[model samples]
Target: MKILHTSDWHLGRIFNQQSLLDDQAYILQEIIQQAVNHQVSAVIVAGDIYDRALPPADAVALLDRTLNTLIGEHNIPVIMISGNHDGAQRLGFGSSLLKHSGLHLFTSFDQLLEPVILSEAEGSDLVIWGIPYCDPEHVNQYYKVKTTDHQSAQEHVTQLLHEHIARHYPHSATHVVISHSFIAGASVSDSERSLSIGGAECVSADLFKDFHYTALGHLHQAQHRSYSHVRYSGSPLKYSFSEVNHNKGVSIVSFHADQSCNIEHVPLEPKRNVRIIEGELADLLAQGKKDPNNHDYVQVKLTNKEALLDPMASLREVYPNILDLVKVRNNEGSTNSERSRAQLARSEMDIINDFYHAMNNEHLTDEQRQILQNVLTELNNTDTERSSKRA
Candidate 1:
């Protein structure tokens, strides 16, 4: 059986303070079209259905419509899980009823071992285990395991699932596992929110060695982790300027009776492409004027020697979707260049003051300076307290 693997919809996501709901809606429609064209058995949405825990009304509506189109109209089965960004309780609401409609929303730890058995006419019985985003605290409470970090929690969960599968499922079944996590050795992008601080969130790729195919999420870049079978399908859209080079797409996995799988990436075309253009103001304007994709989202870098007034405003007159602007200094003799060099010798407070002035075009007032000083003092105290505790 063939299945479409996609995740991190982030339906209510905002890019440069601009709403991306319309673009999101368009990409989702493309995904549905891909599913129809491929004639896949089911769709697996790994996690991060919404941009935040409390999504906007329109985001909810778009998700509802997408689900209705897949499960109601197309009669396709969808297996989805909640990521760290999703409110598990909220996403899991009506999950029991929704499962009857071929929409399996797995969020709770109670459903970890349960398998969504997909029977195929030409392939072996496909057994899928959906593992949602498991916090360290949740794992400790539910599994009675002392997992202090994400790695331990994931290891414990996967071990339990493996043992359960060994005892219950037949050897001939094609096993597939769906999870949202940061596996060790996977490439990460700026768009993905850190699952945990201080690098304790990474789980070993060895945990998924037993499964025939592991569909992962959380990391925005689609990549394999230490093995071909363990992979991340990546987000369907580029959520950050850092991901401007990413070829956003979905993974189509086809499984055979021999427990072998083949995966293909189907590129998704966005309504507006994300691009970066660099040149002087005049050159950039000329290029923008000739470019057919002026409607595309852009980040411009100005390399002009002379200071331009309202450069962003001027650029927007031609490329209306310019999201970011930066002034690049070509020569090292500029005043801004000297300021950058002098900042290395300046004190932290002085540097902060300079930064404040640069950003707001005004010096920090006495009151604001005092507030910053107090904040720094509190942070230092907290650090000392942590150090004492560690000692």
Candidate 2:
């Protein structure tokens, strides 16, 4: 059985405050075309169907159109799950009714035990266990398990699913696990939100050892965790400037009759690619003037020592979609270096005065200085009062 694996659609995502709905619609059409070309039995959308819990009406409509084209028009079976950004209850609405039409939406924890079976006439059956994004608190409450962090929570939940699979299915069937999570050692980009603080969110790759193929989400970069079978399909669009180099695409997995599987990456071409251009202002403008990719979203870094008047406005004439601009100054004997030298020869008050001058482009007036002094004196007096109380 052949299956198309993709995730992190982030349907209503915005890049640099620009709406990506048109870009999203374009790429989703490409995905549908890929499905048609591959003649795959099913499409597996791991998670993150929307950019936010409360998506806009247009985003909702786009999703509706995509699903209709896939399931209604093409008659392809689609299995999807809700990611962290998705509101589970909202996305899972009409799921029970939709399943009759071959669109499987798994959001609840109770749905993990039941597998979506995809089979071909000649190949082995593919049993997919879809697990949605579950935080530690939810997992603990649902399963009555002691899971203090993301790793522990994932481990506990997966263990239960594994036991359930073992009890129900035979050993010969091909088992696939579709989950939304941050597996350890997977590459990350700037756009992805931290699942937890201090790295407590990363789950060990060994947890997926038993599955034939593990399709994961959460991370926006397409990569393998510990093994070839465990993989992240990544987001369809470039969500950040950091992902400018990523060859965004989808993964196609073909399961053979003998339980062996083959994985292939089908690259996706976006309407306008995200790119970064760095050079001096004059050179960059010259390059942009002749560049064929003027329509692409660009981030410019000017290496000019001297400030130029309205460089962004000038660049916009050539590259209309310039999203960000920055001036890179010389490090040696620069303003920072001069500030350091001045700080060494000055008192704390002098340093503070200079800082205020630099920030506001003006020095502190007599009235402002008096007000600051009065505030400082009050703070000192309050500290002294606390000390006296302690004594």
How big is the positional error of residue 205 in model 2, measured in Å on the Cα after superposition?
A: 0.7
User: What tens-digit string does per-residue lDDT give for candidate 1 at 278-363?
Assistant: 99887888888888999889989888654355788778988999999988776656687686676466666776886675456567
Pick the lDDT winner: 1
**C-alpha TM-scores of all predictions:** 0.85, 0.85
Q: Tell me the number of clashing residue pairs for each predicted model.
A: 0, 0
**Cα lDDT of model 2 by residue, 1-391, tens digit:** 7889999999899888888999999999999999989999889998899999999999999999999999999999999999999999999998889889999989999788878897667656789889989889889888887889988999998899888887988877899999899998789999997878998889999899789999998888889978899999998889999999898999999888888899999999999899999998778889988999898988998886433557898899999999899776566456887856754876545556666764564678999888878877898899999999999
Query: Residue 60 deviation, candidate 1, in Å?
Result: 0.4
Colliding pairs, model 1: none
**Could you tell me the lDDT of residue 132 within candidate 1?**
87
What lDDT does candidate 2 reach at residue 48? 92
